[model samples]
Target: MFISETQIEVRYAETDAMQVVYHGQYVVWFEIGRTRLIKDLGFHYADMEKAGFVSPVTDIQLSYKRPFRYGEMATIRTWIQSHSGIRTTYAYEIVNETGDVCVIGSSVHTVVNKETFRPVKFKKEFPEWHAVYEKEKQGQ
Candidate 1:
């Protein structure tokens, strides 16, 4: 599988009263990782939207392993877990500078038509993008 890694520095404002990263901040980190992954694969989420398709998360689950303090560096590892005709699942792992996993999670999203709200099959609309995903997964 092709995994994309993105690094982020924990900001003080993102922390809780205890000085640890707030739980909700991880969800935003997941998006950063996912967006970077898509862009690294030569596809832009904005382009997809411009094509009249919008991908919205249908489900999300996150597990917090350790607390991250402000000013610490964290890395998000993201990969395509699976992709079907209408939905795609991305898995993620957030690790500290020492490579300790701080969080593990996933998000399930479906592509829908912007106007009609109907599901879209990526293969039909973006064949090359789908093919790249398939090839990378098979190579793994």
Candidate 2:
């Protein structure tokens, strides 16, 4: 699969009063990872938005395995787990410098017309992008 890795330094502002990363920050990191993954695969989310489509996460599942402190660097590995005519699911892993997984999660999203909010079949709207995704998902 087309996996992309992104590194982020834990900023002080992203931490809680306890100095550990705030739980909500992980979701932001998830977005960073997903964006990077798509870009690395030669597609831009902005381009899709410009074409009158918006992809919104319909579901998310996160599992926290360890804590991350401010000033540390975390690596987020992301990949497209699955893709269909309407929805795409992405998998993610946030790992510490030592390569230990600190968080594991996945997000499911569906493309919709920006104005109408009706679901869009990606394959019909962007056949080339869809073909790339299908090839990537097969690890070709």
Candidate 3:
């Protein structure tokens, strides 16, 4: 399986009055991690759009463990967990620099025609990209 890791520093503004990072911020972090994962796989969102496709999250689930405070560093670990038809599921783990998992989550997305908003089968629209992800699934 292919995995991507990205580190981000928590800004003071991300924290609430109690100083713990706001719960909503983790969702944004998941997006950042997902984007990095796609880029690491040699695909860019802009290029995908230019090719007439856009992937949008269809579902999301998150579990928060330890809370992160401002000035801490977070490492987001992301991986493709599954794919079926036109949809793919990506999983993530956000850990503090101290090595504790602060949050675990997953997001499901489907590639669609940017203009029509109709789903596009991966093999039909991007065979090469589909092959890459298939190879990844085969323990590459």
- The model with the greatest lDDT is 2
Q: Model 2: clashing residue pairs?
A: none
lDDT of each: 0.91, 0.93, 0.91
Q: Of the pair 1 and 2, which is ahead by lDDT? A: 2
Better of 1 and 2 by TM-score: 2
Worst 10 residues of 3 by lDDT: 131-140
Once fitted onto the true fold, the runs of candidate 1 whose alpha carbons sit more than 4 angstroms away are none
User: Model 2: how far is 21 from its true place, Å?
Assistant: 0.5
Per-residue lDDT of candidate 3, residues 20-122 (tens digit): 9999999999999999998999988888899988999999999999999989999999998887758888899999998999999999999999999999898
Stretches of model 2 off by over 4 angstroms after superposition: none
Ranking by lDDT: 2, 1, 3
Per-model root-mean-square deviation over C-alphas = 1.0, 0.7, 1.0
Task: Name the best candidate (by TM-score).
Answer: 2
lDDT for residue 30 in candidate 1, whole number 0-100: 97
Clashing pairs in 3: none
Query: Which lDDT tens digits does candidate 2 get at residues 74-130?
Result: 999999888886888899999999999999999999999999999989999989889
